[model samples]
Target: MLAEERMAIILEIINEQKAVKLSQLCEMLDASISTVRRDINSLADMGKIVKVHGGAMALDDNFSFIEHNVEEKLALFTEEKIAIAKYAASLIEYGDFVYIDAGTTTEKMIDFIPQKDVSFVTNGFTHAKKLAQRGFKVYIPGGEVKFVTEAIIGAECVMTLKSYNFTKCFIGANGISVSAGFSTPDVREARVKTAAIDGSRKAYVLSDHSKFDKITSATFIPLNRATIITDKLLDKKYTEYTSVKEVL
Candidate 1:
């Protein structure tokens, strides 16, 4: 395709979605990665689109930050959380060693997790208790518990995660952005989430569609580092970066 044609299509996509990842552009244009990247650079240089860390955004696109405590978050997306949690739980298999992150959605997963020969490690105090009650072997790292989120954080927890190689991990994010990746409000908690993802063979970010396009204080992992499982995906461009499963 001609450079002019590709650039025009790219601009139209950005305007429609408010942002576009380079990978998405490459796929949509049926062009090579290098070609798409060069096109993005040219567009950025001409002041037609704003280039970000891993993607381009419309000039008027806004990046906002906000955080809510666990209780408040739990009340916001109740049904979506259940559906997302149920599907996530279905992915677990017997003998799988899993790391479960602390969040309202992930908490719901504990109930749906099938009765099997599976083991779990978690930073959420409530998550640990729930798993143990179900007769599953559960481990909790030694760390200072953050009151607002009720999850364990700090270097100690990170160190503990480093020793385990989990088969699968379910994580939570405060925000999911193509440009900024997966983010959380606290740097310490982000460190814990990063460690878990790095130590696991496979990682999944459990979030509702409400988290999309938002950014937070600290980014734990990049957009491509893990698959996202959400209740709904408003923007399909996210699939250009990594795998996304919409349980709805």
Candidate 2:
């Protein structure tokens, strides 16, 4: 095939799938890896697509700078959040040291978590309270609480995470992208999330379909670092970068 023909097919595949691996593009175009890489570079330079490690993704125009309060977020995606939360909660086992991040979905998870033997550490003030009320041993970090999300964020929160090695952690994200990975609007909050994920043996990011293709101010985790539990996955290509579980 001519270079133009191959490039056009590449663009079509990425646009359709939202993202694609370099190897897949090469196989589809019947071109060498170098040839596909060059075409991807050209497309990236043209601002038609974003180049990610091992692949390319459709350019995302949705960038979130502001974070809505918990009440506002609670009203959106309620059903989907509950489904994802329930599935996340089921992953917790007896005697597990779980870290639950602050967000509407993670908060819902507290409701479904039935393990009474598990201990919890959280940066979310509300999550900590809810977990305690549910008869679980809950520990909250000391830090400046962000009023909008009611989440503890700062150096103290990050330091607190360092002392405990959790068996599992459920985290929340403002955005998830092939290029930007898992991101949130606040840098301080991102730091706490980073610490939590780093200190845990396993990490899961709970999100809804609306979070996909979105970018935020700071990225706390890479795509491969955690499994994603969502309402639905619109892009099959994301599975190539990370493990994605769709609850609905």
Candidate 3:
């Protein structure tokens, strides 16, 4: 098959599977492993997909593929995410009900959350556990656990989230684009995110500069739907919609 044909098929598979391994791609395309690697490399260069250790993932502009891996995610933009999280944590008040979405940035916020009378709801197993262990009134939306990200998502999670009304929600995205809006790789997780946004009175998206101008499949919400809390280094192109907050 032609390179273009192979690339098109690769994109199609990524859309359906959310991720694809190098070996699997070679088998599906009837191409040599080296050829598939070249295709993946080319796609990564074009920003069409993100190359992971053993495979590639759909390029979700709001969040990087790195964000899906717990350890690597925690290391990336560590200082910046921590700063953003601290700022978001400051917005929470005692006795408030808050919903925290899944992402490394939102995870950082958990540590900075002040010890107070607050109820927290989440679809992220890690975040839920951390908050629950920290003495916060934490509620976990029961659902299937996506092992790749440790995110709980599905119909059950969405249903559970819909029953609660949070005073504020701090959401995270895989990618954010003016045109594509906020997106995540997993469609199920996107549904959970939408539910969280709908369940909250006010929604704030916590993202670092790296998340800007990225377009991921499965948009959960439009960029205009929520207030964005991000670092000032964000691309100037996003200045119009983003509430850029400098992390001192």
User: What is the alpha-carbon lDDT of model 2 when measured against the actual structure?
Assistant: 0.90
Which pairs of residues clash in candidate 2, taking residues 3 or more apart in a chain or in different chains?
none
Off by over 4 Å in 1: 1-65
Clashes of each: 0, 0, 10
Give the per-residue lDDT digits (tens) of candidate 1, residues 56-136: 777644454456788898899899999999999999999999999998999999999999999999999999999999999
Which runs in model 2 stand beyond 4 Å of their true positions? 1-60
Ordered by lDDT, highest first, the candidates read 2, 1, 3
> How much lDDT does each candidate structure score?
0.89, 0.90, 0.81
Query: Model 1 shows how many backbone clashes?
Result: 0
* Local lDDT at 25 for model 1: 83
Question: How would you encode candidate 3's per-residue C-alpha lDDT over 1-248 as one tens digit per residue?
Answer: 79998898998897777666688888888899889898888988998877754567775534443335777778788888888999999999988999998778898898888899999988788898999889898888889988777789899999999999999999998787765577777778888999999988889988887777775556788777788888655466665765556675
Q: TM-score: which candidate is best?
A: 2
Score residue 238 of candidate 2 by CA lDDT.
97
Report lDDT (Cα) of residue 244, candidate 2: 95
Predicted structure 3: clash tally = 10
